[model samples]
Target: MSVEEEDCPPLLETCAGERGNEDDDSDGWDEMEVSGEQTTCLFCPLQFHTIAVALDHCRSDHNFDLLSLKAKYDMDCYSYIKMINYIRLQKPHPKILTESSVALWEDDVYLKPGDMETWLMYDFDDLGSAPSTPHYAIDGKAPISNLSFSDLQRQIQELTIQLKHKDMLLENCHKDMEHMRKVTKTIVDSGDSLNKKIPNNVISSGCDSSDYFNSYSHFGIHHDMLNDAVRTEGYRDAIYKNIKMFAGKIVLDVGCGTGILSMFSARAGAEKVIGVDQSEVLYKAMDIIRENNLQDKIHLIKGQLERVNLPEDKVDIIISEWMGYFLLFEGMLDSVIHARDTFLKPDGLILPNRCNISIVGVDDIDRYNKVVNFWDDVYGFSMKCMKSEVLREAFVEIVPPEKVITNSVILTEIDIRTCDVNACIFSSTFTLSAHKDGMLTAIAGYFDTFFDLETEVRFSTGPHATRTHWQQTLFYLPDTIVVKKGDRLEGTVSCTRLTKNVRGLSVTITIGKNKYHYSLD
Candidate 1:
């Protein structure tokens, strides 16, 4: 440990004190009062007369040695203060501290002093004053140690109150966790013998927004979309057919995955095209734009629409292929809406300005048996217990037109040019009359986009239309319901955005007295 210390100098005083004089107060130790003041044990509720005795109790009772921890982490004065405060306020188990690779107190919130004020004690300072310890020296004296006793006491009181508010927030978060756990367990029954363990990431709170954006960084997702003729041609024709509107106009493409739409606009004689994305895919997109010789006409920016700047003051048109499965699954429309509100001119056109989400009943027993019943006998192992979880998530697949048993009903239509973010979460009731007598095993959803220009270019992902990358989203029922030729199924379908993961959707379909819930994540 002594050799390691010589190899690496300790962090300087400015580590936390850089904030202001408030941090300097951490070092104003009044040894006379500090040595006699009563303190609590770090890992337990026991009290000691002095910080030295309290540390000794921690080493013996909890196997937590402060000196050894300092040596292992190469901690400096600020780290020591942070560690003392963390253990006092968070009450974390000693094992968790031992597993850390670094001090793990780099977060400024941990620098705030807690009630213990353990840094004021001599035993804590002894570690910093040791000859073998590395510390920033100024004429053989540390600047913080010269602070007056009163300044330290006042600073501690202010810092302690600040930490109390943080503690309250943490308590509320714990309550929210408990509530979500109960709600999730109720949504999916816990008695399934095949599935007993529920990992923390399965909970919505465990999801990070970065994980959602990082998914688009991969090549396969782009490859699938680029290879889909129906999807690519829809955007291509929308720009080419409305050449009069796109010619000599500035266009902004939000959530531009591979800069395809930007290049399309450039090909349509746009004066300039700006494509913005917040994923690693933008690096490759830069190379793609240069390779196509469209670099002079297109500029690719890497950031969210709300934060990034566009070269033009206001664009004359905005082109984006932001549709997801079931029309609004990934919530990419929110980004497009933000771009519209921030960068587009008052009369700017949004390519594919209109979109329609429709629902149609499907009579595909083969798919139902393959997805759900296949679990009943997986190599003769009776895995029917896994069916409950399988039924909770919607599937994106193609259902043949012949299998559709009812006429399509338009659930909702979104005008991208005028819609806000809240419009994405919507509910609509529909009554689908069966055109032929058949067993309705699932409800399939598809969307159609309209350019609404002079040519009015439009494309559909419905079962009767040409297939696209977003084939169709299917929600299979637990049991097939029999229907006559003229029978109508009355129900309400609602799409809601999940609180924790904004990109994820929670869908509920109610048919008469039965309600089915599913997640699109």
Candidate 2:
């Protein structure tokens, strides 16, 4: 054993007196001397018979300062030479030093159980005495000592797990946003396509005024039936001609208003003719079928095309006069598509295969004066209370010629026979440019349809077209602005179809040399 190891008490020797004297006879020490050592340690003190026994006791119990002991002994006294050197530099004895010296030598001290226990009870006052030192700073700069490499590895693993979870959450959020965007786009497009400005008074089966059509003949006959004498002769002649050509073929009559078209098909020698309509209009059609005594040849069913119960690929011909005020007013063409898909064979024919909208400009001087006077009253006051109400009323009255722009300029004509309603996305945009400058008056718009075999319905710039309960819709410019003949009126009208029945349409107009614009919802 080295001189240093011999001088410092071994850990086992310090606690030996606490145990009963099992080696009392082996050691030469008397009972009084052992008791004195026990009093110093406040426990049992160790006994030694030889140098080897003392060295073994120090190694086993004290974790002795081996490098210091080795310097006094031979260099080869400790088998682990590097371990001894490491302990000499890193582990320092706190008992031999003052409190101030111990604090200054903190970096050289090893963490011991006694030191840890003392730290648990250490007060803030003791910590403040060691200024310029971090309270939690551990002794030594070695990673193994300061950070505990195993604990650090476990923390890294936990962070990786948390990161993976966050990435999955982010991916899910992205998918949800994409789905919401698609749904919103669908709704907006549908709103655009089915919007129309048909007059509230026009009696149509699907419109709000459908109930009025029942008693409408008291005021005026249905527009399609107005030319009854001509329609009857034409129907009879067409039926005779078609029946001879298509003997034993099945036929369908869409919007079979009074079943007149179905009757014509039955008379045309069709093997089967089915008439479908949503309104009690089918009842009227039944009456016509009975009056013509063709009930056995025709079958009448009541349902909308969207939910119509019909067998697929069964009919050879589809016939109907489903046109509304401006070609799409009541969204009747949708029903026609449904009928075509459900009943018609691949080679089936559609009556009135193509319909084109024709528009013309007409002068309405009275409407201009009304709109100007109304705006004047509004501007004269500061309230601005009735702007929306005024705008609504103004759009309904006074069909001015300037509002009429030809489809040739703005729209592509619809071919009902070849058009696939499912695959199609419809958009209608209008750019209104001023043709001539005058006191801005009312704007008017109208339409005409061209059917097969030179048959036509001309809703013209005449008294009857304008006088009917379903008059052309109109919009009056806000206030009269003095405009030059060449001044441009720039605006756009846009429409997107959501479904067969629902559509969205908006018109934006700019009038003036400098182009003042306004939008109507």
Candidate 3:
């Protein structure tokens, strides 16, 4: 910034330091009574040659964006008032003018609109000064000591460089924040896209409908099944006697309705127990844990074993009461086998290690005549058409020991640890001899379960033993077969899961060139 010596104010000296021959002039400068206005900044000690140059210096170096200044520096209205007073160096205004006018700047009283960008937001105090008499530098300039003004140029240069450096850092910080926001938005969008990409069939498979879930989710139907002493006591005794297998071990209970088996595991000193079921009955099972105060030891999950994630990666024991009508009617064994393959440890044991499906020849003449013959006539009228439909289905009812005409034969044996779902679809050949000849009405079937305990605990639901919920499944022959004493009756019984109803069974009987097909719904 250069100043011509001719235009310099008489009260302030023009720099002539290097002009060796120039007169060292201080004629009318030192003793001048300065007005403390122009020729020097009222806020700082920096001097300028003219009022216009001083105003330009104020705008270029000291003026700030009002909104950005307050936000970035955490300033309030009072700080802005101090700043405005420091810029203008007039008496602090204590009152405000609400109205705007074109003459406000032109008049000698009011502040000019040229500085309104920074001053508008701050409350301007009047301090009883009249608007017709505004303050401005007339002939006198604001006074400054020569010692403070010596290094003014160097101070302004250093401050300008610092401001530029701060601007660069602030810009970089904003760029980083914007980049993080975009990355977060992209991750959220990807998760929603993955959910939309899933197939409808897979989504529907998780819910229960009439096909497989409704019948099993109804816990009321299985209340009696769980209470059956013949079925439940066998499991309770087997678990209680073998504490070594369960003590300090991790156990997984598949299809754990009411969580009875899981309670047994907890009582047997298991380190951890996980009981899982996909049925709505699982809510009631949670109550059982609370009732027995076994919540700490046993954890129940309301989900299918095939899909539900277990707490442990591997288990030491897998216990479940998965037997259905006729042993494999509901195909619950499939779920147990799945848990075995997926979660069982290398040396883990499966409860009810083996199961035997027993078949016997029954001379249930009374039961046969009641079901098959009743449909043959309706109120003494010919209704033989219904008899064909009745014969196509099997009967699930209790049969007395006297009704069994032949000794029980093991149709098939299953090792629970190694069996799969396909093990239910089987063909078994049977041979039975009649000690006394009468009429062979139906082929009766039942099953016996065994755990590999020391004493070989056994439980059966056959006609020759105490009855269970699964009374006995009877496959009635269409035509009654006559047999003499000591005569042998031989046939192959093919039991399969029906395609239409997954929880139902279908039986095909082949005996003496006669083939009979019956479905149990």
Candidate 4:
């Protein structure tokens, strides 16, 4: 028969042949077209026995009545059928389809037989064919049966919710970035901020005489004075003998400000000498090296000791002048620890092998009384009107150290020769109490070094001491108080290792010999 013949048999009959004849007798007895089955499709001229076939023909041939076709025939047909079959199959045993029943077959679209291999390789789902087994539920419920259109809808809804959440997170991140930018700009604009570059002249001038006398007088002689002292016969003989201990060995001078110690190492006949520092003082040292024609023996690196890139276990000796004012004020000893761990050989020596810091009670009663009386006069005023004025004048005055009560504690004893600079963390606890009624002046502190077995260095409280410009700095307290004899004060000192040479130390002080106490934090 021709493809367009109206007398063509049904698809089942054409495919199954004679075995499909069982249902033929029910609709037989006439060769004429049934009048009620002559529905015409509006999209095309095709006529059919059912609206479904007519609609399908119209869509395929003329692209017509799309809304009607979708409404009637495209309502997740496979999903619905699979759901029905899933329900029936749950009963178990030889499955059979009744005349009035329906069946659904839903399976993982990607894991079906033909697509399984492809899914394994690419992790992608194939949408080319209907599934043969049920994998999801129909309606909005769990699969007592199998796959359903409602489940697909739910998946789509969940994906939409996730996308919305991601968008909200992105918006918040943008707001944070804007806030950070504003804060950074404000910090940059602040004129006195330390992050801003310091003037070269200011850094080069070293510490002034006032700073020296106010803070460092008790500690030790300056570097220049020490150099002069070393030039004398007695000092020279002692220093020479010390240098002879490390002769013809590799040596490192850390925080080598002017490369003086490195030069000493070179003069001592060390096979090689390397000096490192962050200050521009290396330039002056370079000139000195050339002038003395010692350039061939020494090498200098311009950087922080912690960041100096050198091979591990490469040096025979590690030397440094890292002590800060108040012994632990700037926490530069942390850097010395790093150099010791990374560059020194296991058995190498450290110059000034150890340092001892001690605390003692002293008398300075007159100085403490003056500062307390001054603050009392100011507090007597109506603070509401003079708050700003009081604040502006607070830092201008200086008080004597002895008036302030002190219960000192030893922070730590460092053996540079054996201490692992990388792992050391310094911490301590202290309590300060007034022994007598007085005005607080300043805290007197100092450090002593054991350079080797017999030779030693000490900074003492005296005049005409050799002074290198790096005098100790005073951490002036914000306010001074008056205390009578036998008042007790107590607090703790906390220190954290920050970097190679830097440490952060914080002291908390509580006042009053009895129940009265205040904290700095």
Candidate 5:
């Protein structure tokens, strides 16, 4: 049977529960002048008298249901604009539209129109679950008084969404304050007991780890991590490339910021994936999961791994991006270890099961002068006293591989699946032989992670590899030492968690007769 006008109904009727006032149809519905234009099919070049006819042709002929696609992705007005522009520019096949990820239309460049799209003006609010301003209103061209009845409703809905977002932020702030108070009270109450447990040589001087978890409540830090391609892609490949390991497995993500890894696991055919986080960002992660339509396979809990109870008893795999500067400065591995012991099954595996921290001597006089000597004479005044404090802080920066003067030595190799929490705090002896005759002014540390899958997935945050957010942790010596080629510098490096802030590290380097102490906080 050939499709006709009566067979294909108006576009507004297809939008379930999103129609506006019925009386508006009689109140100058033709004011927009939508008639008399030939609308093109979204997937084909066929022309129709109206948009409803074109959309109906797309559904009947191409089997592309726009309403279902919009509902599935929960695209906002901007997204719809981008999608329309994308189709006009790309002219992708209907199969591509059905199988492609929503991220295909996420580029901001697609927000601009390739041509005038009058069809996008119809049933805008029905395209998204959330209330959002139309893209034109964002440009300040559309005002409330001049807006159509639907646009006016969208404007009010946008304000309601903004109010809800603000209220959520205020509630998160209150929760953060209460959490800080409880942490401070616990630290003060346990001061005497904690001091007795810490070593006598360990010194604590730096900001306390009181706001460690709360610091992730903002979007900037998560943005930095997500933008690091090496860091983000490494996790994605580790989970996606090894589909056999993740298929039908129940996975646990510790410190699952933004729930990216959990979503990856869910997409990799995992039966279930749970993400546990202590920061308020977990709320945002929950919304992101919903937006991506992965809320069914992935679940999130906003609490510490040790305190929270999982919906499932045992998980087949535990994955976490818990590494910090020099591999363990943030003390997140302790939580991962707790999750492993409490929740992981007997045969469960950890993503990036192996991590190796390496150190190399560098002869970067320019960096040494800028970081250390700059304080000696600040604006023609003697400010050398500040150099002591400066030298005690380990700097996170990128050291050119050409500046390296000695061979790299492995400081520690951590097997997350078997290593205990105490493994992170230990003394290791290493010998670095000078590869060239140059001054040794500082020691730089970097780490590499390995997934140990069928095809091992690994990335290095070393000077030679592409830079990650971790970069390299550099510890400057109090004074420089010159040596010839093949000269060996044997030293003992010890890491101890600070008494005041257990999440921070106090590293001590002891050479023959000299010693240097630095803090990684």
Candidate 6:
């Protein structure tokens, strides 16, 4: 509370009269009506009731620095906050920023910067009071004080609407909490019995949780993913071209979404093919097999590969399209490994015998603009909160090759034929020499899969290749680093399987002093 008496020395009569009510209106001052004879400062002792006259006294006599007011608030958008303009016939308050928040308003509408240039009026009243803090923060909340009689009436109407919204959210959260409690109770009760939880103990022990995979069974997610030509065609190419391997062979399709690979093997002259999927979509696979009249050759198993019993003792070939983002994100590869070890014949072959993972430096100016920098001035307010949250999260999307600003480096290669599930987690150091001068913003990961050694049939989920269901994973840097065309950027990227949630993954990348952590959620 910085208050003073006679703080603004009186001005000369002629000078004050020249800068009167007309001047006040021109300087964007809207104040309470006062008589010409009522010349004393209405709010504080100074010279006149007109805001223009009082402002003149403060500016010339009192030394009220406008720049200091801005610096006090660390305000960049000065045009939106007119603290002095809102005060009626009084000098600028020293603690305006500490006492109140300033917002742009016009004709009862809140305005943001870069909006209409006119209608820059101000309102200082707000009492029909809801505590300026969240209404749910405490049991008793009061609205802030200082509103005109008319403004108070309008504010009360607004608070009523907000209170209803808060109540609805509280109710929904309570319901969800109750449901989770029941689920917890069921797990605790089962633990007391010490009995085996399921028929297949391996799957239960190996998987942290299968709830993430259960989502694929709903709606048309699995069906839509199956329709992606880049994914389905790769398996189609591998199975058909290896008909020599499939001829008179017993094949197994692990985690088969719709039995597409099984049908391909059956049509390729396989003696029999077993297709297993734990999703409800498996029911549709039965219909597909019947319509294709391949029931004689393809058998559909509707359970997890680890739990389900295979009709045949062993299979000559096992084919599965189990790759996820970054080649191992979904954790389905573990199930494939289990099926192979338990049921495959000693000479059995895996469809994708080899896979190569790759990483590259990216410019990605367009993506950064959309996801990060756009929040710098959302509707004129500093929506910096969104920018901070996005910086901490990983983005999974199809990245174009043109966005890569440097040469790619091979992170690691996997011979899925000989590679165990635990071997999927890996790390590599890369030296990315800049292809062109640009600000490197992020690092992206991609992988290429090989089907066979005979024909070398393979496809890439790389930026340089056609679109695939397994889109590239982008880890945005905490801060962009500028590089010359030939400058080399050295960094290490380590990817790990999160044992707590098998479907989840954590990737850490380091460049210079900046380190970033991202995850597939």
Best by TM-score: 1
Q: Where is model 3 more than 4 Å wrong at Cα? A: 1-206, 209-211
Best by lDDT: 5
Say which prediction, candidate 1 or candidate 6, comes out ahead on lDDT: 1
Model 1 is weakest, by summed lDDT over 10 consecutive residues, at 199-208
Q: State each model's CA lDDT, in order.
A: 0.76, 0.45, 0.68, 0.46, 0.77, 0.65
lDDT (Cα, tens digit) per residue for candidate 3, span 1-521: 13565666432353322233345564333433433433554346688645445545655665623334445445454554544543352221111111111001111122222222212221323322254211223444323342234434544455577787789989977877787689678867876676645322111114222346556677666787876889888999999888777889999888787788999889999999988877667777777788888878888776567777777899999988888778888757888998999999889989988998988888977888888877777788977788888888888889888888887889889999886666665677778888788799998889999998775678999998887888898888889888778889887777655544656777777887787878877
Which stretches in model 4 have alpha-carbon errors above 4 Å? 1-239, 311-313, 361-409, 420-444, 458-492, 496-504, 510-521
lDDT at position 32, candidate 2: 12
Off by over 4 Å in 6: 1-209
Collision pairs in model 3: 36-142, 37-141, 37-142, 93-125, 93-126, 94-125, 94-126, 95-125, 95-126
Q: Per-residue alpha-carbon lDDT of model 2 for 1-521, expressed as tens digits?
A: 44653664453244233434554554412221111111011011465432233334655666443334434333331222322222233232322211111111121112211211111211222321334232222331122232233534544465577787789989977877787689677767765545733222112233222342344323234544544444444445555654564468777788666666777778668887877766655656666777888777777766555555554347888877665434455446777887777677887777756655432222444555455455546556643455445553314333533433321232336777777542122223343444554554444444443344433322332223444333554545554444455454443322222221232122223333222222222
Show model 2 residue runs off by greater than 4 Å: 1-248, 267-269, 311-313, 358-363, 371-384, 392-410, 420-437, 453-470, 479-490, 497-521
TM-score of each: 0.61, 0.46, 0.60, 0.44, 0.60, 0.59
Assess candidate 4 and give its lDDT.
0.46
lDDT of 4 by residue, 1-521 (tens): 33533564463233222332534554422222111324454434456644445546755676544334224333254443332333232221112111111121223221121211101111012222353221211221223122234533554465577788789989977877787689688878978787565322112222112231233233234344345442222223434677666688888887666666777778888888877766655666667777887777777766566555653348988877676544454535667777777788888877667765533233444543343334545556633443323322212122234323555445457676666542223334345566667644433333445565455544421112333232322223335455567765453332222221233322222223311111111
Error of 6 at 520 (Å): 0.8
lDDT: worst 10-residue window of model 3: 96-105
Task: Give the lDDT of residue 190 in candidate 5.
Answer: 82
The 10 consecutive residues of candidate 4 with the worst lDDT sum are 115-124
Q: Rank order by lDDT, top first? A: 5, 1, 3, 6, 4, 2
C-alpha root-mean-square deviation, candidate 5: 27.6
For candidate 6, the lDDT comes to 0.65
